[model samples]
Target: MIGTPRIQSLPQGIEVGIKALAARCREGEKRIAAALRELEAFGYLQRVRDRLPSGRVITRTIFCNQPTALLRPRRPAPARPQASAPNPASEHTGPSEQPAPEAPAPLPVPPPPPPLPQAPPSVPLPPSLPLVPPPTAPKLPPGPIPRPDELTPELDRAATALLSDLHRRAPQFTLTETDVRQLVPGVAAWLERAAHPDAIRHALTDDPPVPLKRPALLLKHRLTELLPPAPPDTQELAALTHRPRITVTPFQTCEDCDRAFRSPTPGHCRDCREHRAEDLRTAA
Candidate 1:
């Protein structure tokens, strides 16, 4: 080593080491400050408060540790006296002084009086209701017992007259018998035959359709057809003309006699007709 220069005042080894340590610490502080500034520039830290070079906080800080001075409280201004008119008993003399007054003694209060009781109400009497009268029964008029008329027949008159000489006799009863017979058996037979095609065509061709009845009625009906049609002025005559009439054009073979009748009337030939006439005369 080069000759150590004699120093006017020499630092001890501990002192030099302390100086070196302090320089390192100062460099560390500079690095920490630079990193903090970079974070702040990158928006990592929000500058809430400004700091002094000595590291003491000037304003209140949110995240970092730094000493802040306690703010001294401001003294309040002295109160001025009001301009209101003062009472002689309440006038003040000094800042610390107060007005004095005569003391009062407490007074005793008496207890309240008790409530009065009320009397009970009396029961009321009810008036009696009027009684309703019963309804009267209706009166009936007497009827007359007159004698019977001579023309009007009495139910028990014959028995009374006949039983004049007898006592406790019952009257005889009479009942009339009614006779009912079916003379025309083929009333709706033609109506059923009207459904046939030949009958339908014939009805279509004819001025009016024929009626439904027996051969005797048909013979009479054919004779009626020979007469002229009625005039329109007389509705009764027109109705008679318009009235349906049937006619039987009998075939050669007769159903009743089994003999062929050459003429139109089949069952009652000229001989049969004479026989029928004589039978009718005998019956008359």
Candidate 2:
């Protein structure tokens, strides 16, 4: 059995049994069992289950000089795998120790979260402003006034004279030079409308409002609101075309009867006035 080609050529993982061993040794089962018991007692053999590369488990009979050496777990073969038959004359090296695993990388540390935004500071409010009184209004709406350039110097002088006489006409309408200057424009505009000087004075002084505050503003409102309409176009054209002549004659003492009368020339009475030739014939 030791030098047989069949036993040598057989695969590594054959089934384990005492019958096959007894057959090979030409002994009965009882004698083989006795031999196996003696081998176990002497620590030269051990039977254990082993796994094959094909994932099959089978009982294997192991022979060793020292059974304690076989107790250490053996890693899988590196150079030659157990799946195929090993070469008969090949020299096998010892199993190498396993390499240690490298330490795992340290866990990364996250940066601190961004600082929370700060709130804005509060501000105080300013004090409220005081209320003001509104200016007083007149009884009428003063329309647009004539420009200073539009008023003639003579008309301005006449307006000033007429406004100056208001105090004499009505005792309450006393005014200052500044007030008169400011009102001259409105009065001159009235004169432009052909309003007589006496008529303007009468209209202003006739019914003066009691407790008059600003005389200039009052007069301005009256002049604008109560302005007269322009003269008729025919009369204006006739006056423009043929200027009318007015002769002023003053009354005087008559040399004959010492009576007063109207005459174109000074120093004359009613009978002293020259009569036309038609008047003499009518008298005859």
Candidate 3:
């Protein structure tokens, strides 16, 4: 009989289904189908349906550490017979029962071997090698320095994306013309390495102004640095604005948990709960 303790030690559903599965395992079609159903119900169990030597699909249970009581003991194999040589006297004597021949004489022993010579002592070498001059390193010419006009497009796009992510984070910080001009020098220098120089210039132009992204990014970075991570629900944000009916600004999401705080405490999103749980764990 299969041991209850061995099966009970396994994951829950599999343990319960063991008896039902044994008979089905012998039946190829039923075995795989039953395993599949079990797997679907309990995702933790990793079972595979494989084709047997009989060309039929069967459930192949893997990684089971069944106790001795749960499994049948394998039968021991029979020992092999040893081969014997024929008797020499019997082979030679047919009609005349002849005796065995005498054994040959032993060889003579030689005189004692000579002793081996001992090895000579090792001599130390004198350390007086002449010093050779070291090889000179080649001098490399300095590369030409980049000018402001050398800003590339790829650099601009990278800066823009970074700024966009930052702006999304901090809504309180407002960007201004002065801010753009202040960031222009460093951004122009960075643009030299960017692949798309024109894109960066377009972003900075006064029309819509490209440099706004930099200041916006800086504001976001500062805001996150100043504020604590957000609470789970938008209720906190709604209370801050004193507008329960109003929709929350996308940037107002909690730094800790990205839950929109427009509504009351209980209305927080599912992710907010996990975020809060993690926060509690860390705090503890």
Best-performing candidate as measured by lDDT: 2
Error of 1 at 95 (Å): 3.4
Error of 3 at 93 (Å): 99
Angstrom error at residue 187, model 3 = 3.5
Residue 194 lDDT in candidate 2: 81
lDDT at residue 219 of model 3 (Cα atoms): 38
Q: Which stretches of candidate 1 lie over 4 Å from their true place?
A: 1-27, 50-57, 60-284
Q: Which ten residues in a row have the lowest lDDT in candidate 1?
A: 174-183
Model 2: how far is 209 from its true place, Å? Answer: 1.7
Candidate 2 local distance difference test against the native: 0.66
lDDT of 1 by residue, 1-284 (tens): 10112111334322222233335344454454554455445433223333443546543211111111112122333343444565778656756444453233221211223344677787787966546534664444422211222212332343233223111221111111110011011211222222332342232223322443232333223223332232345678788889988976656765557666776644656677788899999999
What is the C-alpha lDDT profile of model 3 across 1-284, one tens digit per residue? 32324334657435234445565345454554565455434432333454443557756343223222213332333333444566776665358554454333222222233445778987988987546644665545533322345446755555445434433444433456555434443454544434243444334332433445554454333323322222445687777788557565442455455655644443456577687889999999
Clash-forming residue pairs, model 2: none
Report the CA-based lDDT of candidate 1 relative to the real structure: 0.35
